[model samples]
Target: MQTKDHKVLVANRGEIAIRIVQACRKLGLAFTCVYTAEDAASGHVRIARELGGDKSLYRVSSYHDANELMAVADDAGATAVHPGYGFFAEDYRFARRVSQRDRKLIFIGPSWRVIRELGDKINTKRLARSLGVPTVPGSDRPIYDEMEAEKVAQSLFEFQEQQGIRKPLVLVKASAGGGGMGIEEVYDIDLFRSVYRRIRNYALRQFKDEGVLIEQRIRDFNHLEVQVVSDRSGRNPVHFGTRNCSIQSTGLQKRIEIAPGFDPSSIEYGFDAAQVLRDITQHSLAMARKVGYDNVGTWEWIVTRDGRPFLMEVNTRIQVENGVSATIARVRGQKGVDIIAEQIRIGLGEPLGYGQEDITFEGVGIEYRLIAEDPDNRFTPWVGRVDGFGWPERPWLAMHTHVPSDDPYDIPTEFDPNLALAIIWGKDLAEARERGVEFLDTLVLEGANNAGEPLRSNVRFLRDNTGRILKF
Candidate 1:
């Protein structure tokens, strides 16, 4: 068990830090927040510290400065390090260095080995198959070269033919990509060849590697995820329900998200996805135990028309929308961060009040990711200071934002060096929807609208359907 005096350096920025800080406070640990100069005034920095973090760092660049981050953690006298989502959360090398430092840097999630395994889309699928878990119909290995890709494509066609499909729509996917990046769909062999060739170069630049996966494309499919928590002890592996993520816009220039989705019951099969969720959790835990995994994490899946759930990927850290799931589970009084605290306690050989089954979900919760983007101009990313922001007296509303009054309202462009994210949660699907709409209505952005089209579209969609748009 960790002593209450544990000082943890949060090696991340933004709303995720805010969430982690809450857990640390509840567990009675001294938490610190780190940020680049750009994020110095973010809400994450404001909420966690009794006096805010004494130590903050700056790098030459705004994002992905791994070495500088590790150095800051070392300098902070921190007993553990919590890498909130993004940044180096899944970077094996960072975790290895932290572990080697012998400062008891708690990863707050999976081990480097499991991360290494899962980060490789090729190997992850192999592991899934070995565990008798269903994976998307795709190449078992990352395509190495154009020739190899062609060979795999040919074999895929043969397999499709055997399945009575003369032609199959396929997606050329970048193995190391996430958050809907590095994915392309091609309906025919010719299109696949042309798009595959183009995406290969893009993947090389984005992932700094050359490996892609060829998989069948599932159109009009609901993107759902099962949030689960497991410990190093290999006991009480459990599923924490699902989140629907099907309301994304059609193009890159435009970006929007909805929750609860279009029709939750129409996608009732998503509930049946628990088995797949269990398999993913079990497999992920087994992999973690084999490599010493712990803390809270999530397993991502996509349910197809045939009512089969296919493994997509695994997130080694708490997800952005985790608050929503936690709120829903809170109906049974399971606060999201409480799960992490319990898991951390268990991982550290501490005690817990109850078993996993003791936790049950109650009403629905909607979490809308409010970003600094313009809803006009095809949803180009824009950033600026919040001229005014307020939440009206509304039911079931919990707001999280990063902007501070003292900060400048500098307008941001698509390539703005800094960005802000806000998440609002509500109770029950209906209540959550009402709260989200009411909250957005009260949100006012000044300075710039770089991605206005997408932002407006998203707000309008949420206003129209609450969070149910995500239930697709």
Candidate 2:
């Protein structure tokens, strides 16, 4: 009911901010955006005003500062705030501040307490295990000292030996860390203490949390996840099947596709695809409902060699790979499940627009992250102007980008610009792969480097790894 009358504030940067702007227009709502000084000339900022953002309050780029963003919303008379999947999307303090009455703004996300609970790896893992959801074998509590770290390391080594794994690889993770930070992988048991100390120090510096835990690292694992949407009315959660996100060098996701991946060679795990589609998704939704999860979120999992699935973590906001959800919705004969819009509605005290039985997925969607980084040069940031930009001509291709030739922004080596995205939809994984690769070949980002080489890219890497990344 509050869908059209509210003026929403898009609080974040890059593609996600631009995405919220588009959603606002589709819903007949006015919106505002906040960006950083570095993103002053980005497309998201320039186009937001044209889309719906109030031009007067749209120029400022101080995105990470919660107090500043809330103030911006107040000045613009925004009725709600949409923190687009980064910066403070999972920050409880920021959510709490937005929920304040003087602000009178609806925080378009999970409740602050839910964010707080999900932010803690220990608490989330505990919750999952309590709900009978399987999780990776690891320490039951935080490793408070070096002795505990040693004990955990030896236990993992024994597990590796039992499983015939050559190395007992383990990951030390911080309770509050995200984006692959606050984590250290230990290959040798002898080096456990030092690595633990290093991770503890890094966690203290970054997340300010001294809590750390270790889990057995499955070398041959498939990274899968379920997208779940919950409304504030306590309705049963709606789920959009699972996604195959196993292709990765580190934790940085390079490509993602809808269920039923193409080319079995690309997927690394040993699982029955059809059964997993039902089990993992139901497992995720059941676990979330057991805990009364009250907003749209992602439930991540890792599948082992034996086809066993385990809970990894929950992301309490929209993910960059959400295009798969959109494409799947289209296939299921359901419309208006735009996750961001539903998030707003839930915050505004409305029920989810559709029930689980109302939707059915029918196709495959592929999303490839396009960043301005030199893969050959240790993945360093390539900062320069877009000499030439090109893309495929098709109705199903979705490109979310922020770069512009008129007034371009530099890609900093210290941060992840994640400037562009390519999301394509198809009837199946094979067609999606073919179209994806063909479309990728047409993408030409030139004139950035001094050597005149095309924007030191990764399009080829994605094409080459298609069949190589599927579950076995």
Candidate 3:
């Protein structure tokens, strides 16, 4: 109903930003990007402009400087700002600044008001509970002191006992935390004070909000999420299948598989995996509709071994693994599935143009994050000039990274650690698993190491973890 020709400013960096740049080009929208001076030579900086993107504004330096970004948007005559996850993506203040009274710049996530409510964990949990969304068993109130934390821990343990879960998994985590930050687990009651103090300090320092909550951490839980897209009208919100990010270790996401995962083993659990998927997808759509959610966001959940799924939180922005959704849509024969482009269109007052009945997915998609780190030697960062790099010459296999070029040896590195992402699709999980191995085997990262000892990359780890990528 409210459609306008829009120009967008990508307010982040790295692969996620590049994804947006590609989407803007495909949709024929004028685009701009902000970058730190350190990233002046980055691949995104070059590619975005090549796709008819605006040149960088010489004035803005800091990526997190909301004022400077606002100035850039004004100077570039951009109509919308898409904050790729991290930095100011979830920052409510940045949202408020972008949608301030004067400038008509659209913030391409949630409204600033919704962000204010859901960005804080306590408020989000309360809202989710009110909407009948299943949440973890824990205290409704924020745990502030030792007494409060201990009391909450006891209640959580009691709940765990009732649920027949045997793991001292009482967690005190930051209310305003994401990207695996501001979290601590308590295994011992006597050590509660120390853990509480440490977590509280970290939360205050990192999130600038000491708000913490206690939750019963689901043991052997699988991380899952449903991707949803909405328009300004809010009548046509659609779910773009689901993704399993359980292939993570030590709280870092290493690999992700979409559309019911590549694990046939998970189907052996007591409850039906189909039931779990149905429940999560239904709950996610219900929650988004309840809020009249606009733009694109993800509904994150944690499912136990028994296939019981509980809502974790809503990421109110474009996610890094959104590529999986797009690829899955394509594999299912749904063309033109650019989520970032839709987010911009919704922000600019366009209807979703379709309803849930119009969407479909029938295949598996997996994304392997190519960390510029060694799989052996404790996953140490191995970043430097890439002597040579290559991948399998397959159109079905999609890769997002700064590592390859017309000249394989021309690959440059800024040593930012996360180097690339490889995405592949298959008609089923088995086919998906096989293609993953093929992709990894074909990957050729033959550069001398930064330490000059040996070449290092996660391709080996991914290849080795073939059948067991879910547990990682």
Evaluate all candidate structures by whole-model CA lDDT and list the values in order: 0.59, 0.73, 0.73
What are the models' TM-scores? 0.81, 0.90, 0.89
By lDDT, the candidates rank as 3, 2, 1
lDDT of 1 by residue, 1-472 (tens): 3457677777776656776677777777776666656555566656754444455333324447756656666677677777777778888887777777655576665667767777666777777777777777778767878888877776776667777765567778786666656777776676667788778888888778778888776665666666666665545455556666655544321122333222343335545544544544555555444434455666666766555667777777776666656555642454553555554455444533355567676555565555554444544455444554444544455555555545554433322322333344544455555656667787664443444432222455445555345443
Please give the clash total of every predicted structure, in order: 28, 11, 1
- Model 3, residue 317: C-alpha shift (Å): 0.9
Error of 3 at 110 (Å): 2.0
lDDT per residue as tens, model 2, 216-325: 88877778889888887545787866777887635454444555432343443455666666788888888668767778888988877677788888898888787667
Please list the Cα RMSD from the true structure of every candidate, rounded to 1 decimal place.
4.3, 3.0, 3.3
**Candidate 1 regions with alpha-carbon error over 4 angstroms:** 45-50, 53-63, 102-104, 157-167, 251-293, 331-353, 374-379, 383-386, 393-395, 405-408, 411-428, 449-457, 465-472
Worst 10 residues of 2 by lDDT: 260-269
List runs of model 2 lying over 4 Å from the truth: 53-61, 139-147, 162-164, 173-176, 200-213, 259-270, 331-337, 405-409, 412-414, 450-454
Better of 1 and 3 by TM-score: 3
